[model samples]
Structure formats: structure tokens, C-alpha cells
Target: MPIKTPSELFIHDLSDTYSAEKQMTRSLPRLARAATDPQLAQAFEDHLEETRAQVERIEEIAEALGLKLKRIKCEGMAGLVEETLSMVDQVQEGPVLDAALIGSAQKAEHYEIASYTSLILMAMKLGYAPAVPLLQATLAEEQATDKRLGAMAEASAIEQAEATS
Candidate 1:
């Protein structure tokens, strides 16, 4: 296999995120539908919108840096989403399922948070200041979405579980 340079790695990171977000736009609606809880559903919907905007920002940043956006086929995201879907599939309508679903969703968000953080640092190191804010914007949205998922998990997961029991 060919080794990637540090700069190549940085661009690959951006490409990976772009691929993940593009795939996620398709996945979010399925997640929302799988979620039995209204709050969980709404969270997915909101993040869908946010994710689209994030993709746009990343594209803008790529353009400013004279780089074309590409896909590295983010296998991590694909696996995570696939696992979440399988987990949710077995969940019966109740709080436990809602809680489990929320947990899965949050796990996914945390992955995105880590990916974006590293990408932002790389962009800055590569002298892409304009890319910084765009990265920051996506980072903030990912964080916000993660936080929202956490809140939903706290409020609904256990309570729903108890009620179902």
C-alpha cells in the first residue's frame, strides 16, 4: 500500500468527513423513523439539516484552499450507522428501546466530534485559516447534536425503560 504524507492525511480526513456526512444525509431519516420517541426523532431531523449545512461549509473550505472535495469512503461511519440500525431493529416500543437508540446515536456523534477536531487542527496547520471557521461551524453543530442526544438519553431513556417495565 502507498503511504500517505501528513498533508495527504489531512486532505483524506476532509474527504472522509465529506463522505460520512453525505451518507448520513441518507441515514438520518431512517434513524428518525426507527426512533419511537418524539424527541429522538426531532433530534435526528434537526441534525439532518445541520449536517447538510456542514457539508456545504466543508465544500466552501475545500474550494478556498484550492482543493476539490472527495470521498475516502468513511467505513467507520458506515459501520456505526449499520450497527445502530441493527440495534434499533430489535428494540421493542418502550423506554428501553428509546434509551438504547439514543445511546447509539450519541456514540455516532462522538465519533464525528473527534474526526472534525482532528481535521480542524490539520486545516490550521496547512495554512487554511478560512477553513478554520467552516470546520468550527461543523464542529459546533456536531457538539450541539451530541449534547442534545445526551439530554434526550437522560430524560427519556431511563424513564421510558421504567415505564415499559
Candidate 2:
């Protein structure tokens, strides 16, 4: 459907985020398994649960708005997942791979942060008051996840990879 109004645009963006969350659910497990650092692996696992809740929040927003989320593919997220997996295949599994995974995960987190920021602004503008909090909560989670990944990279992944090289 062509977006004819701000409301339609909001729904379109929401659906895109829904698709991205679904894709993350599918890809995160592989990332968890591939991560050699126990803490990093556990972070992936933890985020998977958060992602599931985030999906539910989006559903709640959709139901509240009386909008059915479109069955759309978030190509942006798909590209990120594909690029991460491809990088995984090219790198040898270990600290280097862990570093790569962190980089990929951070990329995803940044993407999500931007998406959620837009979503919150759109929700507020479209008078989707209920959705603003939900979107904000997810945005916080994404930001926290990005911070955690950055800390992990600094604490170990990058350093370990550098030492190995």
C-alpha cells in the first residue's frame, strides 16, 4: 500500500521494525553459538530474550493502534545479517571471530537504535501515545545492548584479536 498519510508511514516503519526483530531472533542463536567468549555468548543469549519481548511490545502497539503489521521484509536487517554471517564464514573461529561478531552485533544495535528513534518520533507525531513508551523501551534496550557490546569489545574481543594478530 502506498503511504498516503503520516499514520500509514508510521505503520510502515513499525512493520519494518517487526520484520527486523524477527530476523534477529533467527540470527542471534547462531551468533551466540559462534561466539567463543562465554560472556559474549551469554550476551547474545540474553539479547535474544529481550528481542522476543520487543516483538511482543510491537504487537501490542499494533493492536492498540488498530493496525495490522504488514508482512514485510526488512531488507536493511537482512543485509546486516547476511553480511555478518558471511564475515563469520570468512573468519577463523576464536577471538578474531568474536571480534567480528561484536562488530556485526554493534552494527545491528546501531541500526535498531536509529529505527526505534524514528519510530518513537513518528508515534508521537501520529498521536500514537501508547506506542511511544513501547518504542522508547525498545530503544533503551538497543542502546544498552550497544553499550554492552562496546564494553566487551574494549575489555577483550578487540584486544584478544589484536594480540593474536
On TM-score, the leading prediction is 2
Error of 2 at 81 (Å): 0.2
lDDT of 1: 0.84
Please estimate how well model 2 matches the true structure, expressed as its whole-model Cα lDDT: 0.96
Local distance difference test, each candidate:
0.84, 0.96
Locate the minimum summed-lDDT window of 10 residues in model 2. 1-10
| Colliding residue pairs in candidate 1 | 95-160, 95-161
Candidate 1 per-residue lDDT over residues 1-165, each given as its tens digit: 353787778777888998889888988998888777788888889999998998888788788888865547999999988988888788786677778778888888898999999998987888879889888888998998888888877776778688778
The true-structure Cα RMSD of candidate 2 reads 0.6
Report the C-alpha lDDT of model 2 over 124-146, residue by residue, as the tens digit. Answer: 88789999999999999999999
- TM-scores of the models, in the given order? 0.93, 0.98
